[model samples]
Target: MTKNCIYSIPESFLALLTVFISSCLFAQQNNSDPKIQNQFWKNVQFGGGIGLGFGSGFTDISLAPSAIYNFNEYLALGAGVQYKYLKQRDFYASHLYGGSAIGLFNPIPEIQLSAELEQLRVNVNLEGSNTNSQDYWNTGLFIGAGYRSGSATIGGRYNVLTDKNNIYGSAFMPFIRVYF
Candidate 1:
């Protein structure tokens, strides 16, 4: 009678294990249903910046277009292209064109933080009697934070790497970002 009791206990345990395994498989199948999956293109956002300035002997015009892929509500990665034209009277004229990659995070709905790596190819031509031209590359790493609105962010970013040859005159710059 003790042997029969031991054999019956194993059978009971096996039945319970089978039921548990079946339930788990059913849940997994429901989660993997194609109707519930997220599409890739739905996660993309596009935005950029534009600037124009004119002075006595200086004129600056710039255009930058960018796109980002948001993995969720909090994190995004993006890239952009930039083109800028500048002319300073009796000093120099230059054309800058390049691209940048950026990563962004939002801890709360009202604040956004970012890190960006930018590279620009610069071509400078001396004005006045000398018509010498020089070409080089300028790179910058920027870290920044900003206040967020509906689809726009207003913030300031500081270049972690800036020197005499850096494109932007200041290490700190205020920015406005808009995306849709």
Candidate 2:
């Protein structure tokens, strides 16, 4: 003969569960309310950068997409991802992918200052005499300032971590940033 088994619920657990459900039901701005959610999303801004260049045996194309949460009129925090493809005739073809975190400060309406940290994975294929493949990681920390007008900013940033063998080949990079 077999006996039936019974599991019992603790009184404390039952009371906590009742409170949780009640609080959820009485919440004024829960995620289930689309209006409140939309208000929260209104604080976010989306933006990115794109590059395309082709000339005498050289081709370069890049795209970066980013988003930011504006805490107020003067401060914002954001993140972005980038991909770049480059080819130099008979020399090498390379692909780079990276991501970055950025912080922005606007002391005045027309001036914006920024700091960004980036990390990238580089894959290169040498096409000529020493045909081979190379893979490595590169990182950069950039500090920049820009002139802002409406949704666009024209600026330049310097990478403090620049080294002779760095992928960008230069410490200073010019940029045009736009957001919508």
Candidate 3:
């Protein structure tokens, strides 16, 4: 019985080690395969969105240019600039910095959701005593979704100044995103 006990102890330890090693191998296999890894540099991406704005007695559209640095299989950081033009009312522009992350929820990927915020300079063509000049600052929120493969996104946003100058509205934009 003593000999049997010693022999079983080694066998049990060997079994545990085998399980540990195999589990690690399984984990590696479960991650995206070589093809996915190669495509990862498609990781870094750049894109832009355009939107139309209404209200405040203006007909306006906005152009947003953006850049992203993807850091991993599921996370990225980005910054964007928006230029808004009113046919004859006001001009508004802003620069935004933010981060993003994506999750593959299904094998047939089709959609993604993202959120963002922007530190903003709310500028407009204010009729000055002499000339029109911008005179406001604010922060705002942006939220939206993307349909994979289409390089298109639709989003809505709003902005308000800490001092009560409000530029609140929504926009619709189609985007073209290219990954490198």
Residue pairs with backbone atoms closer than 3 Å in model 3 (clashes):
none
Candidate 2: residue 35 Cα off by (Å): 4.0
Count clashing pairs, candidate 3. Answer: 0
Model 1 residue 138 CA deviation (Å) reads 0.3
Model 2 vs truth, CA RMSD: 4.1
Candidate 3 displacement at residue 91 in angstroms: 12
Evaluate residue 11 in candidate 2 and report its C-alpha lDDT on the 0 to 100 scale. Answer: 58
Off by over 4 Å in 2: 1-34, 129-132
What local distance difference test score does each model get? 0.93, 0.91, 0.55
Candidate with best lDDT: 1
Native-referenced Cα lDDT, model 2: 0.91
Give the per-residue lDDT of model 3 (tens digit) for 1-180: 899999999999999999999999999888858787777557667776677877766566767777766665345567777666554433433332233332222123455455566655655544433355555555655444566564443332222222335454434333344443
The C-alpha TM-scores of every prediction are 0.76, 0.83, 0.46
Cα RMSD of all models vs. native, in order, equals 10.1, 4.1, 11.4
Worst 10 residues of 1 by lDDT: 33-42
Each candidate structure's count of clashing pairs:
0, 0, 0
Instruction: Give the alpha carbon lDDT tens digit for every residue of 62-106 in model 2.
Output: 999999988899999999999999999988999999899999999
Q: Arrange candidates by TM-score, descending.
A: 2, 1, 3
